[model samples]
Target: MFALMQSTRTQSLHLTVDAATGLKAVIAIHSDRVGPALGGCRYLAYPDDESAMIDAIRLAQGMSYKAALAGLPLGGGKAVIIRNPHVENRAALFEAFGRFIESLEGRYITAIDSGTSTVDMDCIALSTQHVTSTTAAGDPSPHTAMGVFAGIRATSMARLGSDNLEGLRVAVQGLGNVGYALAEQLHAAGAELLVSDYDSGRVQLAMEQFGAHPVASEALISTPCDIFAPCGLGSILNCQSVNQLRCAAVAGSANNQLTNLQAADQLEARGILYAPDYIINSGGLIYVALKHRGEDLGTITAHLARIPLRLTEVFAHAQAEKRSPARVAESLAERLVYQKGV
Candidate 1:
């Protein structure tokens, strides 16, 4: 564990267990150089404690890169609450988790992520002030979708020589809050949509509402399209999956899309313009960070407008260096967060 921390340059790792509430959580603080660690809390079942710790560590590191690349005055951390399927009281469980957060004081501020909701945030707020995405704070999904939409346009401009989405085919691989919202925007822009999800209801809804063609989840990666948006889980793009892709570009709101750094090189070799996940999917973090600092909606929107410009810069640098955008983004983020070139 210490070796992992040293390798990733993570600052610290914390854990807490409340037997009564069945709360078992791990928090990984990747860095606090720029500011306090800010990230989301994920509540999902894991195979083991080691898996949970690794997830938290990788996600915490991504959050740090996300914040640094977005030019936010915040560091990165992440929390994973190993789900207790048999727990009777959900609120009590989250509240106990909140107390664990409070114990860290202000070092970590958590919001909503996968398997978590605003209600959970409210419950967490009951014990600690270091929480966001409460009902009052509003959902960050739309903002995240908005940023991704802009990023897709920017990516289109870089790869296709045009920012227009009309008449283009886009395969979206998730139907969660962010993915569904992005599909709505893409439909509004007259983009042809091919959508897949584990939930039949969400896929049916997309078909009925957005005229999206339904594709099997397993086959979506191989589906030919102008853009492949992975708005779901991480590590979707691995060695075999990369070879299966038939898209011109990859962009979405997923965190850590590449299974490893070498995956970026593979995408580049295959002539796929890869939008680094952390850089393109930072809309929610921006919304949460600015809102926490009391910024208005106008201010937040203005900040979001920078996503495309930053991505354009990354693309230009990648083109100049003859490297993948993922590598360029990682190098740039490391320089900012670590205060030295990697």
Candidate 2:
């Protein structure tokens, strides 16, 4: 564990054990180079503790990059609670987890993440004043979707020479909150959607509400389309999927989209544009971070509007340097962070 943390340059890794509630949680704080570390609390049933620790490290590092690219006065951190999805006593467990957060003081602030919700944020707020998503901002999914929508336009504009999404075909590989909302936003922009999800109910809702065409979940990524939006889990762009992908570009809300840096190279070699997931999907983080700081909604909205502009800059830099957008984004973020004192 020590070697793993050292190799990743992780700042801190915390473990919480609550025997009574069967809560086994890990909090990974990657950086506070910019400001207090802020991220989301994820509740997942990992196969083992090693997997959980690795997840925390990867997620925390991703948050650091996401925060840097978004221009927020914050760094990155993440907490994971390992438990069954259908755990019987959620309140007690979360409350205990909240106390653990309190122990960190203001070093880390958490919000709703995968397998968690605004209601869970409320429960977490019970023990620490360090939780967000409990205010009027509510769910950050819509904001994330909005940013992705803007990112797709910018990517399309650069690659295809027009930002208009009208009549464009989009294959959405997930119909979760962010994915469904993104599909709706695209439909409103006059784009055709090929939507899929493991849950038939979500797929039906997307089709009924947005006129999306349903595709089988497993096959959506390989479907031919103008854009492939992966709004679900991470590591989807591995060696196998990269060979199968058939799209002009990929821009979505999922974190850690690349299996590793090599996946970015593979996509670039295929002439596929990739809007770095950390940059494009940072709207939700910006919303929550501003809310945590008690910044006005107008400021948050304005900040969210800059996502596409920054992405455009990233695209421009990538084109000029003849590098992958992911690499360009990381370089841009590193420069910013270092300029502010790495």
Per TM-score, the best of the predicted structures is: 1
* Model 1 lDDT tens row, 1-342: 888888888899999999899899999999876588999999999999999999999999999999988989898999999997899999999999999999987999999999999999999999999998999998899999999999999999999999999999999999999999999999999999999999999999999999999999999999999999999999999989999999999999999899998989999999999999998889999999999899999999999999999999999999999999999999999888888321
User: Please, what is the whole-model Cα lDDT of each candidate in the order they appear?
Assistant: 0.94, 0.88
Please, what are the lDDT tens digits per residue for candidate 2 over residues 1-342? 888788766899999898887889999998876688888888888889999989999899888888888878887999999976666789888888999999988888988888888888888888988888874558988888988999999999988889999999999988888998899999999999998889999999988899899999888989999999999989999878988999999988898899887899899999999999999999999988987777897998999999999999999998899889999998887777657753
TM-score of each: 0.98, 0.97
Evaluate residue 340 in candidate 2 and report its C-alpha lDDT on the 0 to 100 scale.
Answer: 76
Off by over 4 Å in 2: 135-137
Lowest lDDT block of 10, candidate 2:
333-342
Instruction: Say which candidate scores most in lDDT.
Output: 1
Deviation from native of the Cα of residue 85 in model 2, angstroms: 4.6
Runs in model 1 lying further than 4 Å from the true structure: 340-342
Model 2: residue 53 alpha-carbon error in angstroms: 1.0
